[model samples]
Target chain A: MSDKLPEKRKIKSAKKMRDIMTTYYLDAMTAKQNNRQVAWITSGGPVEPLVAMDIIPVYPENHGAMIGASKMGEDLCIKAEDMGYSSDLCSYARTDISCSIVKGGPLGGLPEPDMLICCNNICGTVLKWYEIQARYYNVPLFILDTPICHTQYSPEIARYVRTQMDEYIAFLETNTKKKFDYDKMARVGKLAYTAQLLWQKVLNTTAHKPSPMSAFDAFFFLALIVTLRGTQIAVDFYRQLLQEMEQRIQTGISMVPDEKYRLLWDNLPVWYRLKWLSEKFSGHNACLVADTYTSAWCGAIKYTDENNFLDSMAEAYTRIYLNIGVDQMADQVLDMIKFYDADGLVMHSNRSCKPYSFGQMDIMRIVREKTNIPVIMIEADMVDPRSFSQSQIETRIDAFMEIIKQRND
Target chain B: MNNKERGSIYAGIDIGSITAKAALIKDNRLLATHVILTGYDPINAGIKVFEALLKKAKISKKDVPAIVSTGYGRASVSFADKALTEIICHGTGAYFINPEIRGIIDVGGQDSKAILLNAKGQVENFAMNDKCAAGTGRFLEVMAKALEVELNQLGDFGLNADKPLKISSICTVFAESEVISMIAGQQKRENIIAGIHDSAAARVAILANKIKIKKPVMMTGGVAKNKGMVAALEKRLGLTLIVKDFAQENGAIGAAVLASKL
Candidate 1:
């Protein structure tokens, strides 16, 4: 008998891996199409938009992430660990190094970048992270500094970013040895804006009987738009997706195909354990009608006639989902409840990503206080599988549903 | 001649970042052992390991005498008769594995922690990298996707690393870009592999230095099994390490052994 055997997969895990890699491929395609000599991007949030830009964007997060998740981040995590970076530093950074040498690393994924662009909106960690990538990959790093947006982007801060953009565009042009076509930029921006508007419309469509789409649909939608932001096919696919969803809404069709307890999901999902969560939630007649992550993309601001493109871009980067703190996060979910006619909320208090995990207790309190909605906190991770205790999350969801049922009754 | 006359059983449980490990020793003879992921529910995973060890050894939970839990999630294990921090377990276990063992660096799913022990395996002090998931078990899981390989293959990959390229993404998010760039550069996979392991080793070595790494260094963790990491550490530190077969499980085994003493 041969030692070689079929790879054991729990279908969804395979899908997740595909999604992750597809995300990589889409970003690579963006670079290839732009005919740019170099492009740099981060893995989670930034890569998606860059992909839509038709410029090849590289994600530094993928490199060290696996090492941290696989009990190996420590080895790679040691250098910063030695410098007093603390074990609590992001695992992606640790494993990014791990992937570099632990065989088949970034060399195994995408190409070296000519330019690096990171935004400060997501977390304070980005500046340091990009700095690392700049040194390690030897690329000129650019910061899309949307100064800590308190409430919203002030005009002054917006202008500051616009100035940076001017420099950044110049740097990008020099690096690519290509001219910056304003027409192309404007066209791509409009297409992206259209995609955003449709996605918002599709999300709004969920208010009908059953949501016109499932969380699974939204997850795929995120990848397509985020990773393929700049392509016509990507835009068309989303437009088609919106049309299908609109039809479902008009026809009174449900995304789950069954009218269950309409619910709201909040925070980054336990990426590795999403299927288990979705399956577990689905079994209880509870379908997630809206997640803040999906909704966050729906309302993306677009600049056209009167709006300055750079200002709009600056606002978009600063106004990311996790940028705002708890009260705003609660308000977003509250809006979803009314829009999706949701019955309850599920909040994932991820141990790995603590920034997103903040004020959930307060958010839960407020949600209960404001709309009288039932809220449950599922302790899990967006990427790492170990943080997901299926039983714990399952039990919590079951209990949360019972609470909802009792409340509804 | 008291409990020794009747025969004593020592069980060690090492709760790790990614997996929980256990070992049972009846006097001098090794009884049985097992490894299981801590999963999302550390309590459940720990208890499951407990049940597994009993079933595997064909001994009732009562016969185990005492059990101990140690690791990132050590405090969360309710089933353990007692809980010892991974620092204590790793130091003690390292000493037991080798009488000369002085420092133990252990990494797990969401944390990278190093333990320093006196000659007697008692912890003098320790340093841990915990705030972020970098330099932990989760790091490997995320990086494997970029490398497109199994976590276990990290050792072989690092060993093959010839052209060590410096990896920049210490934060997992940016690292993705770093890896993607490496891939696009058409660089050899082995060179990138060396860069990753060496950088990871640098992280652990930093912790070693904080404790002031001593001779006859022994490393135990899931990473200890990776040929690339061990080899890289050997090259970096200029000392050979004694890695146990169940390096990852050593904490659990150590915990169990500590349980019997209590």
Candidate 2:
């Protein structure tokens, strides 16, 4: 063996991303001193309107992910449970709820929201979570109730959500006491659309022979698309990210060395164990090429109309990955499997997100019947470390990889 | 002989949560096996079990050419040539015993799994119980303690029940409390034991159904020795299970077989 150490394959853009996130949080933290209105919004909620209205949009779900990554999820989750919130509630809701009172987390809790925007396109837990926060902060809460489109997006459902879009704009105008800028919204919508397209390209770069980046990196780089969407900053950053991915592919730099097997992930990441899980997979020469979670940000881009921004926001927000039927979701998973050329599938049966975890068994069955690859489901919580069992998960992953190796050999 | 002269002998050590087992194989034939309580030190247990197995086989440690370690404490065996998970080892062990076994339901001390095997005895698919002890061997041990009965006696006692009571809780702690209430209500011990077996069988059945396990399934692991649990699982799954000798040491045997290849 050579005496020299192996070269580290760290992504150079990570530093810039971290710096941008730090500045973003700093801006949110001092929003009051800077005389900027901050609207706390859901991860799946529409943020172009907020950007058009010159309101800084904040995401508590992102904060929950940050808390989970910081390994402070257990204390906040326990605090919420102590406060009589059921342990069964979503971890994001629990962490954000407790964080509001305790002012905990990486940035000492998010800036006090001038308004709260909740869109239940992802899960029903957000309604009550935002309600609790609205009552605590004594702010006006705007709820965009997008009914579930099980089979298809019906015309009546579109009309219902479209009317709510008008009401949403009216609520924003009333809270911020400023006129909604349609011209700026047009520009923001186009930028948002471009950012999503660029994000999809960044994800697609992994479809190469050896993935330039894995889903773990996507989970980290995803903060910008979710937090800074509908802004020139997000568009420019993703453009650079996509270029970096292409460059990495050209130089033959893959995330997992000797990537022998490629796997696709499902549901939210176990944030607290991101590094551990990544290392574990890379140790086995398996790269998680793509995931259903990060791609959900760009998955709904097909429904958007760049020119008529407000006209198509209803359908674009309503027909997300979580809002659609299980069969449709299975089809998307199958497509991802083929597109990424996955050797197997690893599904995280998250305990916190009910909607995401509810139909995973059926999806597992569907994937098994439709493909020859092996599939494994790991029970875990995205944010709550209490639900995680490290040794057991380690064994399962090892066994799963062994099966894959057996099949290929 | 020194190590190189007798290279045909291979060894496997399985360091489980409650017990450590070791097996020796020579030229694809079973040589000897030994089992002992793991206690608090798995690494030491692995060494002790291997030494005892070598003694039982009337051979020296130097005769074994390769060693593969398995089970929950697989990584603890620093001397192993390699470490593998119990899932693949169990499937291999069952297939080695009876190549006709298309599926295996292994209920070990802490976890239970249902594995589907292909024609060549390779694991095709598998499903394991979540991070709970509801359907595992530990669940039965806990119930046996509550009933003041020996762990080995639960199978026979459960067989005598005329009407098995229904157990509603899937959580081990809650199920224990439920058992306490039944005892308070003067329920029969055999009936309660039967109920616990059925509840645990029900949980294991989900794993079987998840993988869509085929017929000719083998029951392995320490819990396979319990005839009552096997019968309950058979009834729940609408199929019989094949339980052969050395069911508990199947993982170690499989590991030994793999070590020979290594």
Candidate 3:
């Protein structure tokens, strides 16, 4: 992070090449000129803060996730394993590698990451994932060390992240040959925060009877927000989106209408198991009204002031996902259930996502005690299709539904 | 007393996370069964279900020769004379109920499980999804609640769907979203319901597919009562499902059957 600029923008040509490559996801959508560059905003690591900087984001994790679902997970995993990457490491790592190799991807096939940022928040897999990309297409890699906190984040960790974030801006300025404008960024930060506030407001809109938003819709919003958090366009986009939801709420239009039993879902979904989950309950006329992930990510607040944006960005950017606390997680989920007017609860006992799925039983008990709501614990994994069993989960759901109906009666 | 008059009364408690079910067997014949909500406390729920069963049978706990327990919270019940795995109990119970049953699909509220049994109804291979409610009793409960229908009526609604939806994801969160999308598309409620039933059937098919599903899949747990889901599943696999009359209490009955064997 020295104040040295390369003789020629080493990445200028490379960024253009990557944009030309990634224009696939804009399928059936608006076509853009070369002025519209694609960005990859990597998940779990130093991503949200990068928006504060004026570079388009490119997330490598989403690419990896796509690879994980395709035929490439085992192949990439074998390659990584051959290189001594342990099998015990998350499959997401292998999936990212596969994504790099596979020609197939979402959003017109994702663009190759221009600048890579790695944070310790999601874990070491990201460091390795970014390292592979940085070497593959030579680029500047910035690593942000989010010091783990016990009770509250130690100031030292905050200092470390602040220093890294400062260097990131310097790198962007030098590479772009643009002078750092604190005022412009601060204005953008304020705009970004407004967008975030609107997004949060949209999520809170579920408080309306027959919520205008659903967890599925939130995932889409997350996709947009993650990619466009710090931009004015994002603020406008969210403002319009919130307005639409406001209309829905005003009209009492339910995302899924004819609501009978409302339920709060916990933890990450078993991706391979989603089809079965929807049909089983929808067949029975039940809808999962809310979940921990949608609520948590949907509530992400943006900090718009760049002058002292360090604390706000750090707090919002490195949220509960960055800070692991089971009790805090449980409380947030419990609060969301009531907010959604949910009648029951679902806790996914995922084997893959231990960081998210652990303490599910304890959380279930607490939710039941506090809300007197029926809590159903179903087992599955985040990505690995092998970990899910459909029948046992159905049996458990059947019992929970009976309780709901009985209670309603 | 005559030598043929000795018919031991056996009680089995299946203390699952979502529900506590109890079964009473006298002289190898089913006497009574009860299934009740776990409500916050599994142990107390187990006791309540057991008391309710005894009351239904008009008999005291003293008359029972032995009591056994099974399920996630089975070990927590101090009153049970012995504890058995839900696996062992389910196999025994399925075999006793229908000797032709080769597979036991026991879906509970908190979890969903697939247990493979031999001719003897002993567990040979088993797979369980105790991690999520995507394909279990809890899933159906949510859907039924959404429909404003009783749990008992879910199967009927599913059967009437003129078209069935293909729910693409198994995660409950995504499933709900998928349902919303289907509803947004102005799909029929019955078709949506049928589609949901297929989703559960597909999940069960995954577990049942793992091992050799010879014949006569004994679909149990609260989900078995849904004729829509079970029938839809039957049409999908081109095989008939043997749903027990009191599938909700099968786990506890399985435990009692295992107790009788022990």
Candidate 4:
């Protein structure tokens, strides 16, 4: 190894981020003693309402990611399979389902939810997943159905989702036994919007020649936007993180030293192998400057109106990345490629995520035809380590980097 | 440390899952090549194959100034100057052999790949089989064992087939059961062998078509030696494959070509 220490390249904000996440989980774990209601919501669900209601918003998908990063996914996934779930089911759902029974995640298990909020905008799997959890906990469940915007978001679709916004507030009122606070929601909505913009700015820092942070860092920092959005905590945390990124850029502290080839990643990260993958790319002087996954938390910001957060959110949440057409998704990807000036694209054909992975082939072809960059698809699961093939993936990445190097040379 | 001062000879070692291969070159011409079963110890196999190749080429190890390694066990060759992926090596090797070759379908012991090359012999694009052994050399090896026929004789037996049967399963284990059922039904051995080739061809053809493989394609790797599999692939892909004398040793040859540049 070089004399330059590994810790020298690490983001100093990481320790602070970890502390915040630990505190957040601790508060949620003791929600009962604090007389706080916990609402387990989907990652793509509108969490601002729950935030405004003073209910601790817990995310099972976030918990799934934690299990994956801690390398507890394989055993939990096997347990779910033993419980008669198909091996092909989403690993997040499987891990969450099994973690409920075994209490076997990084945190023993997530605190029991007083209510559940399910949104189908991200995937159809969440509907069934949340339904199963609702039955398991015997709690109230609210489902928000968003029509897929294959071409354009229509008024009819907007109306349907907007009505659910009212029902969502009513559901929170019924479950928490408190009236909906519109003023608090307005403030939360603005904070959520501000956090997303800051998060986007943080992600865009990678557009610098020597990216201050890699997508791997983004994956770590993404937890706040996903879990603590709509809170001053998330907004304040991102502002500080963004300032650190700008400082790193001013000081020329690149995540990958001697950064040469910049690549863009698609789909969820192989959470368990993030470090391995980071070092592998870094070995080639390649930095994964940006990714579609982390940016997803901020991708639909153009549709949001902070001044009128409630009404515009219906459209914003409905037309998010995974809910749109493949062609539209490809368009967004192409835009990102140009913005980031990426040399290559690495697509993860995740086995567990059907929506994210399904149209990837079409997107890959589109990128190939539109841009003169090399694209490689790695078949793997985000959480389930058993589906990962180390040697095969290594060969593919090496070969892909070779081609990129040749083209750039 | 100048390669020219050290005799201007380059060496390459490719340690695959099932076999170890070595090749040597001097002044842009291939000197010698060697192959042996990789077995369990790839590090030992890599050394043995390289030493055997040097002996065959009448050169000492120190004379070969630059060495490159490729394939699955590429990193096992600790002596190599650089380790490159087989995709680039194969492309460079095929282009060195024939500049007209624009695409390559390499079906190795455990993996199948279709690579597209630019006019300069650089890999433009490529695709590999997923985490499965459905269309690789090992797939045919398993079928040969199930049919109780010698691996080398599979081509002749398949070529004699009057009507090729169709094997439906894309999985190796499931396909073996399909073959057993055909054997129980009294299907001819030659026909069963032909069916097996067709199944493997169909699977490999998908990789070729996925990258839209270009014309004048070259076939490499151990599976290229099977005439029946070649014919099936030709029929399925609607293009003839260029298989030369060094087909099985192509990866090693490519690695050697890259070593000279190092």
User: Each candidate's interface RMSD, rounded to one decimal?
Assistant: 16.1, 0.6, 11.7, 0.4
Q: Write the per-residue lDDT of candidate 1 for residues B88-117, one digit (tens) a residue.
A: 676666766677777677765655656656
Off by over 4 Å in 1: A1-36, A43-54, A60-87, A91-95, A103-107, A249-253, A302-308, B1-262
Every prediction's TM-score for the first chain?
Answer: 0.81, 0.98, 0.79, 0.99
Scored by lDDT, the top model is: 4
Cα-based TM-score, every candidate: 0.54, 0.97, 0.56, 0.99
Report iRMS (Å) of candidate 3. Answer: 11.7
lDDT of 4 by residue, B1-262 (tens): 5566444889888898888999988888888999999999999999999988888888898788899999999999999999999999999889989999999999999899999999999999999999999999999999999999999899899999998899999999999999999999999999999999999999999999999999999999988999999999999999989999888899999999899887
CAPRI classification of candidate 1 = incorrect
Q: Which stretches of candidate 3 lie over 4 Å from their true place?
A: A1-40, A44-54, A64-87, A106-109, A174-177, A272-275, A298-311, B1-262
Model 2, A300-376: lDDT tens digits are: 88999999979999999999999999999999999999999999999999999999998998999899999978998
Off by over 4 Å in 2: A1-7, B1-7, B184-186
Task: State, as a TM-score between 0 and 1, how close model 4 is to the true structure.
Answer: 0.99
Query: Cα deviation in Å at residue A133, candidate 3?
Result: 2.9
Candidate 3 lDDT score at position A101? 57
Q: Write the per-residue lDDT of candidate 1 for residues A1-409, one digit (tens) a residue.
A: 1111212111122354355556656556455465654465653333333433345655555433433333444445565455555556665654454444344432454455777887776667777877876897787887777676557668887788778767777766676566777666766666666667766776666677756566655754565455455556556666666676666556565645455688888776555455666776676767787787766664445432213444467667666667765666777777778877888888777665666777787887788778866666666555445555653344346546644653564
Lowest lDDT 10-residue stretch of candidate 1 chain A: A1-10
Tell the DockQ for candidate 4: 0.95
Kindly indicate the candidate among 2 and 3 with the higher lDDT: 2
- Per-residue alpha-carbon lDDT of candidate 2 for residues B152-225, written as tens digits (9 for 90 to 100): 99999999999999999999999999999999999999999999999999999999998889989999999999
DockQ values for all predictions?
0.02, 0.87, 0.06, 0.95
